[model samples]
Target: MIKSGISQIGGKYRLKNILIDNTPYHEYFLSLFCGSCVYELNKKKANHYECFNDKNPEIANYFIVIKKFFKEFEERRKKGPYTIISRYLYDLLNAGILTPDDMIEQAIQFHYKIKLSFASQLKFRGLIPETTSKKQFITQAKKDFKEAAKNRNRTEGHFKNSLGKTTRPISNNDCGILTPLNPKLEKRLKYVIIEALDFRDLYNRFYRSYYIKKGLTKEVFIYADEPYPGTEKYYGNLFKPEDHQDLIEICLNSPFNIMLSTGGECGIYLDALGDAGWFIKEVYTRYSTNANNQNLTKEYICMNYDIGKVHKMVMDNQPNIMNYVEG
Candidate 1:
């Protein structure tokens, strides 16, 4: 899967081993909290229409920008532009330059800063605006320097060198700039449909309309990776208890099939879903102890439809790694 350029919660790592097998009635697929997982799955499908979405605008825009300018970015990379661009941006920011009017330049700045920051958490979430403080800017710019050292592909965060060597920081060594420098296969996103809108709007209008209009033998499957309640949320988009209930209700009431991945829904969350015929299966993964290290954790996969009717949709809870490559 394309990394989607962010350190997402669970979608990326759960792709190969995820137990949800809810099939669509037709060739159309709906990735509710799309993130990076859907891209990998889409690459596998021969012919299918997909609606990939994330409720978070930043995440959505992340997908949208890559889809739009990846080709143009590729052309620039071929002409050896990033070495200059990456270093120039880095130097400008390190010197406490704050220019936001230039859109492309700003985008590129975000591209580099994000990769370098911890866990890809560079949204400036829960943080205040930038004052003209060299000290503050330098504090942030240091993260960019660190990212340059870990030159993982922009479409990926898994870093390892061919010679098992230390990744020395180069002048133009930003991960995002270096990423599109590659042939752009994993991140060849279809920009036409990727959007940054609220999921409720997408579901109520776009998806619902499509589901009604396109009545076929195949089903429409939605895989949502919503923020679990009571966790320190990413990007400042906190999920309330009622929000989870509403999401479950919406999925339960929809004419299509959906799979939701979340943490500890408790009786209030699951009982409502269970009463509406939803099934709960526990899926395990790792969360950090200090929020940076992986501590073994468990999340749930709730489906709105019954799998007993479908003879093949059966896989019990089995643990797997984040980077499991199926042989």
Candidate 2:
């Protein structure tokens, strides 16, 4: 469980909440980047635009306006698709039905659509826009997609080199190398680790370290070729909503306390954990540099036991613990 006040709206710990809510979807489009940043920065309660000004005012303003502009564009586009909107706005400007500023806004909206469509096409195959009138845009989109696909394939080939000849999906029983726990936790946790590795290599490393610390053996690992839903398949399988739901159910039903690592991956898991009524306590990571360090490295644990009491204790006795974990 997380400590008391850890989830408060201000301070270093606040970004965790932002990451949990925005990362999977917000990272794809540039316009929504500021909203994601604002949420992570704990400025969601205040004016979304103001959050950006607290650090980089100019960039923040740009993002804020972009977000607003996109919202309006979306509303207007509901009457038609981007091509129709572009034509109508252009005609409106030519006929004096729209002002100069309106024309510019419409153009910006069109530009945003072009950029977004091009990026999406490049990221995923079979995404070519059907109504883009500009041949240049289509050409560019195709080129970009091919290049991106090439790069992604290259990266995947490299990662695949690291895994041995275990081509089939790993079964729960084959994951005995993971930390031993209640049978329920063991089955579910192993699957989580395996599924996470399908998205992030670093997550696999973290899980490996976690199991080692718990005195579990290592097992053969595998990655699913297809992307998980709600995320681009390019980076491997995206973390799905159902994945989170499963995790929360497992954690809530568990007999022992749950521990989570800190980072984007863990943040995703915490969303479900929060929904399931688990709170976080202290966050710890094994250190390798300190002389007293147990030489254990690549492990993080967020203890969920007595989260409220532990949080209060840390707040009173060690207010700096937040800084420690935040850093």
Q: Model 2's lDDT to the true fold? A: 0.31
Model 2 lDDT-worst window of ten: 24-33
Candidate 1: 10-residue stretch with minimal lDDT: 123-132
Residue range 1-327, candidate 2, lDDT tens digits: 121111111112333442232222111011111211323322112111111211222233323334434345334444443333333444454455754245325533333332332222211111233433434555775675555444443454553322234333222221111212122212211211111122234333434453445433212111111212233332222334455444444345433333333333355555655666554443333322211233332212233344344322111232566687999
Query: Which residue pairs collide in model 1, if any?
Result: 24-218, 24-219, 25-217, 25-218, 25-219, 25-220, 26-218, 26-219
Positional deviation of residue 139's Cα in model 2 after best superposition, in angstroms: 44
Please provide, for model 1 over 1-327, each residue's C-alpha lDDT reduced to its tens digit, 9 standing for 90 to 100: 335544554544653455435432334556666654443343334145666776655555555556666665445434533344344455565456855444444445555555544354542221223334434555666776576556644336666543234443223333444654333433455523665556677777655465566653235666677766664356365444456666766776777777676674355656777777777787677654332245677777777766656533222243433236663
Best by lDDT: 1
TM-score of each prediction: 0.63, 0.21
